[model samples]
Target chain A: MKEKLTDSELIAMVNGGNQQAFSELMKRYRKMVARVVIGMLGDTPEADDVGQEVFVRFYQSISSFRGDSALGTYLTRIAINLSLNELNSRKRRFLFFSVKDDEQPLPDLADEANVDESLSRNELIEKALAHLDPKFRSVILLRLIEGYSTKETAEMLGVPLGTVLSRLTRAQDRLKEIVSKLSREMVINTADTTAKVKVKTELK
Target chain B: MKSKTFNPEKNIGNFFENYDADFKPFFETRVMARIENMVMSYQMNRDFAFRKIFMPALATLVVVFVLAVIMGQGISVQSLMGWTNIDMESAIASSMGY
Candidate 1:
């Protein structure tokens, strides 16, 4: 019967100090939260940190949940806000250190990634996605990766539907740009390694 | 070089469509433990605040009542603040028989 109860029912129980109900709620939605967060944050430790904070904040504010929106949406909204905060702070830190985006560029980031023939296409895409600006990456995460509707993504981001649309277009363009850079880096790195091997063979 | 028309939405889907978000086994345990700690700390804070603010006020009220009865005197915010408005003094003196 507990398993059959709706999100509102579980929330009511959680408000009444039922930890099991809260755990059930977390189990039900943690994967979705992880996808949205990890998509935006990659598989870094920061993603794990934000992922935990989402549920913790939800637990803290469980009493105020009126069920106006789906519980999933409510939780996803928290995840997005926290992830965006971390991204914004990171950008500020970068700015404080006088790191300009144009000066740093995507290929430079890809040069630091684990690129080899052993890497899958998915891994390559993930690495390419890391180079995307956080705003555009957020659009990609919510709209394309998580497959939320445009209106839903707008509501999640607290932006206009048209803004989500335009951001989606620009995000796609940026993703393409990064992937192209990634591919070019892949070629250059492969060639460089091969030339090194040829020189070693000649010396031998 | 052959130019490729980049389809972001489709490619993003391609990368993440089969994405599996696997949590370490301790994730749920860690979260539940944190939630419990949060609840405990919150209850502790409420109890602490109640003890901090309410107990002293209750004690002061009891002490004031006992002293007022013992001394046959009036207790009032006006008298406490040493204000001497005529109407207030008369009303308070009449009310407290002091």
Candidate 2:
């Protein structure tokens, strides 16, 4: 899908001390990196931060690459690993209990914005995506969200095509279920609120 | 063969319909900034390598050339000018057989 300088050309330019070529490589893979970050971070501000860090890391180590994998695949793997690390650290700090600060436990998820209410269609899709585990989510994002073909996704994730297919199918099914559940809840909540309001008015 | 239902394309399209061009724009600047940062790092690395390698190599060559010239002048010119001559034949014979 990408057409421009080949990996060898870019590597040569980079080794030759050509900053412009390095810039070109960044432009080439920026979207791919951003998508992978977004998949893991679920549209948070941190996705961009994490995505930027991935490229920075990639650029730092570009000289050491042995050309075993495609450059794009290499960058994506770095992005995925970094994004997962960020997510894990955030969860540990925020989601689980901390003994150090016992002054009023952190507000439950109820205090956080509702995923179903604030999310746009794309955000809803992303929110639904948050339900799947990272392995499946990586494959799904690469295949469905990023529109990479099956073979491409397999290559990117370094998994067999069969594995990609199965994981993607499962991931899609899981996302569909999550979205349906959220939509149903929204409807039920709206109906319940209306009913309660009507009953209170009649009593008054 | 219970029932095959749900079009994959339709579902795929639904996912794409969620694509946020706005979000994409927000990320573009971020990505470019990242690229710039990477480029800066690469430049720094290149600078480091040049200093670490090429500069030292040049320095070594310069030192070796100066030493070689000084040694050559001290030995070769004195011998050639015969400023401290010993018998050449004796010198050759002694050096050969000594």
Candidate 3:
């Protein structure tokens, strides 16, 4: 919305310590970064915190930004890296907490009310995303969801373009498999709704 | 195996598109605030660095001035430590190096 300035111009302004320019850069890419965070971590509150950390880190390092790729791509790469690290640490913490509190009940219904079937779809995709290794997940999110070109994805992730393509292929396959499994489960659950309704009506 | 009824790639893309409509508006604000905070913090740290260096230097200069006045003028250590301004000529003459 800020007239889509070239990355070089934005980089120049940021290096000159222009706070508003940095803010403008953020305004352009925050949604994309949040989506990447959510995609990597699934819609958890931690995503918001890590998403903020991502941009902060990007701002801190904007001076080092060379215009090898688009600014969004560069920032996305940083966001992905930080988000993955946060996700790893969170997973470790959860394991530790779980071990300490073996009897704690994990909540089952996270999103029960206002059941946008789309919400479930998002959750299913998120679950599948959680299954992939972080490296593959980064590529998949950048290319598929964020619509980065293969060359751009490779540069952003600091890998070869072929690696991006390969990982993208594998990630797509794994994601499809996960989504299919989830779809089947959703179908089975929906299929039993009539019987559940009849039982509830009978009890009433 | 279960019958392959769907293309997973297409499904994945479809899943993204399905929820894409729900993207909230404050996304840009969130990112901008993060960037601003980061730059602001870095600026604060640099300012702090300057202060940290400057304050100690200023303090050292003040200390050297106080010490030079106390010792260079042959003032008694006791009176200098006590913050008492003794007679400089008597103090120097008594020491026999005036």
Comparing 1 and 2 on DockQ, the stronger one: 1
lDDT of 1 by residue, A105-155 (tens): 554635546555344555565676677777777788788767889999998
The DockQ of predicted model 1 stands at: 0.30
Clashing pairs in 3: none
- Fnat values, candidates in order: 0.35, 0.14, 0.39
- Displacement of residue B10 (Cα, Å) in model 1 is 7.1
For TM-score, the strongest prediction is: 1
- Residue-level error in angstroms, candidate 2, position A23: 7.8
State the weakest 10-residue window (summed lDDT) of model 1 chain A: A101-110
Which rank order by lDDT, best down to worst? 1, 3, 2
As for candidate 1, its clashing pairs are: none
Please provide TM-scores computed only on chain A for all of the candidate models, following their numbering: 0.78, 0.67, 0.72
Off by over 4 Å in 3: A1-20, A95-120, A159-166, A194-204, B1-52, B58-98
Q: What DockQ number belongs to candidate 3?
A: 0.20
Estimate, for each residue in B24-71, the C-alpha lDDT of model 1 and write its tens digit.
567778888887787689899999988998899899878877776576
User: Comparing candidate 1 with candidate 3, which one achieves the higher TM-score?
Assistant: 1
- Give the Å shift of residue A81 in candidate 3: 0.8
| Residue pair clashes in candidate 2 | A122-B18
Candidate 3, residues A111-141, lDDT tens digits: the string is: 3342223325557666667667777788878
